[model samples]
Target: MLFPASGHTKAHVLHYYAQIAPVMLPHVAGRPASFVRAPEGPEGESWIAKNPPPGVPDWVPLVPVEHRDGVTEQVVVDSTAALAAMVNLGAYEVHVPQWTAAGGRDAHDRLVLDLDPGPGADLVVCCRVAERLRQLLDEDGLMACPVVSGSKGLHLYAPVEAVSGRGASAYAKGLAERMTVEHPRLVVASMAKLERRGRVLIDWSQNASAKTTAAPYTVRLREGSPGVAAPVTWDEVAACRAPSDLAFTPEAVVERAAERGDLLAGLLGEGVRGRVP
Candidate 1:
């Protein structure tokens, strides 16, 4: 279905996952995945499949996660077979929480900061805001890695040594609020679009329990062509002129992983402490 736009076939997408599964699984395994499938094609309508749909093979693992109202079964992409199956099922994108299944819903393994451009702003502005966040994180004795969202912005992730969902949420929220106060010209923490005008929003809500960020190396279905949520270095972020500059297809992503290894692999281990008082 995507052959016309991206020149990629279903087989190509599956092969891409098959090749990158080794590196990708290390980051996604044991996490509750919210599969974003585009069965109709990149340009066609798509839906987010939270629970394992009917007819899923028994080999596919499922994790029961509690929500505000009740508990639901979420799929975990732990194996190469599972990843390829999802791709064959038209799951173009995979979004997972910062925690693992062993940690369940409480223990979070990482902290993420999503830098989104406001209404009047673009990705260039987003890059500037990300740089400021990196500097602040550096002062805190933490290391933050940048990942191109492959759409409109960048996401910064830092490994949290020993932190829970609550701790991560509070720390990220505080930092975002602080950025808005310290850098009023370029940053805003408000979720309101109006408040985001001419500024880049440091979205802090993704740190909460059960929240999911787009898994690295997954392809995003957007206008024109699909874009891969590829990991990038700080230098690439600063040098980028537009969002498309960081865009990658399935083929490009696999090649990138082969060359650079997993840029996000370091985030899987113990990192700087939250140190929130």
Candidate 2:
């Protein structure tokens, strides 16, 4: 099932993902080409490629792609060149019947935590880090969202401007860094892990305008499926199961969004034109 039908290597399927690269473009519309491909390896195959992959062994799906009668829709987007190409091709990120969002109207500042539990990191520790972050935000009356990384970790994000008048970026970086510094045992925001010893990165750097974190529902080509992320409320996170103990599936995620409506819905409709202001 992992093998591609007919005659395609997993590498070929990965290349196909790169060739498409239109899904991520629209979401990052206002930003410049800070987007980079996910990176290729020695054999030159990757769904996205911005850097040299560190022997990320040629990965094939652990599970077979389920048959849905039709191709499970997909979108690819990376790099400014890719964004331009997608627009030229008339690709757009829109509300599909399967995926829909509502409510983010009030122009609140957004700070998403791209929680990467690390390649070999412990999941229990990841959940603990998220818990601490939530406490810090709630004491300050901030609105945050928790999401599954779709790979190895969990992300915890809090809306800054909603509570704090300004200092949105500063606050996000400050909290992310503090999580690493304050709890040396649980977290790390350092880009270089060896330098950080052993710790999970809080990853608030994605808050910068020039940067863009993977949007919700976006796929990480490495994973067999779309690897869509799961968004959870602070209350849910408080109950605290464990990130490693959980794998938020695509069906569960879309289902959850449908039940609660999307927290980012209004933010998506904030009317920020793609053009630079």
Candidate 3:
């Protein structure tokens, strides 16, 4: 079983990934990806893998990512078979950077802001913060889309005219700082735990070249029910009265994708590209 407590097995994980692959692959395909592996299930030890582990099939592509120390070969899940291989390795959670391997390493095609709720705060507060962020992004000529992170909080993504990773980070950080100053009670830009109490943190650091966020449609390795980082509509975000409203299961996500298609597909288009300024 991959999720022992929840009674979900490795087969379940593979099936979910297979069903979601078509819509999911485009978003993650050229990105340097990382995986959170729970070999003995969620209750057992789990680790993050940036480099491919041994025994990976030859068909899977390993993209090289350069760090200050050296270059690490990161796995890129470009096809359904590759995604299945990741699942077989006990990875339920996939994390990827804003920039893709196909695009220049330093060039970011999107800007992401992770809305993290601190103690005394919950998804309801996160929804409020997201709405405000959507407004801010809209004013900046960027169209923002919301994805319920499944673990906690939400993530906001906007398509941008290829900007440098540093530039994306600076733009996101500036927005967060501005929001914190304007809405001190509701938002906290600082990463400090004490300051974030009862507030939602606009985590802008994920835009850094090396940082990663849970890819949309990734299944989070959490307790209780399986939660998929499902993309959501603005209407759904506004209507999120309870956390359960946004919390989606793997089965639910497959069905939702069938009906709504990829809610974030607009981010892939060249049209409506927003400037970092």
Candidate 3 lDDT for residue 114: 95
Q: Which one wins on lDDT?
A: 3
Rank by TM-score, descending? 3, 1, 2
Q: Rank the candidates by lDDT, best first.
A: 3, 1, 2
Model 2 lDDT per residue over 194-236, tens place: 7444567777665543344555444333334434455555465
Over 194-253, each residue of candidate 1 has an lDDT whose tens digit, in order, gives 888899989899998868999887777776667777888888888978766777777888
* Clash pairs (backbone) in predicted model 1: none
Off by over 4 Å in 2: 1-44, 47-108, 162-167, 235-245, 263-277
What is the TM-score (0 to 1) of candidate 1?
A: 0.93
Q: Which lDDT tens digits does candidate 3 get at residues 176-233?
A: 9999988999899998999999999999999999899999999998876678999999
- How high is each candidate's TM-score? 0.93, 0.55, 0.98
**Which 10 consecutive residues of model 1 have the lowest summed lDDT?**
268-277
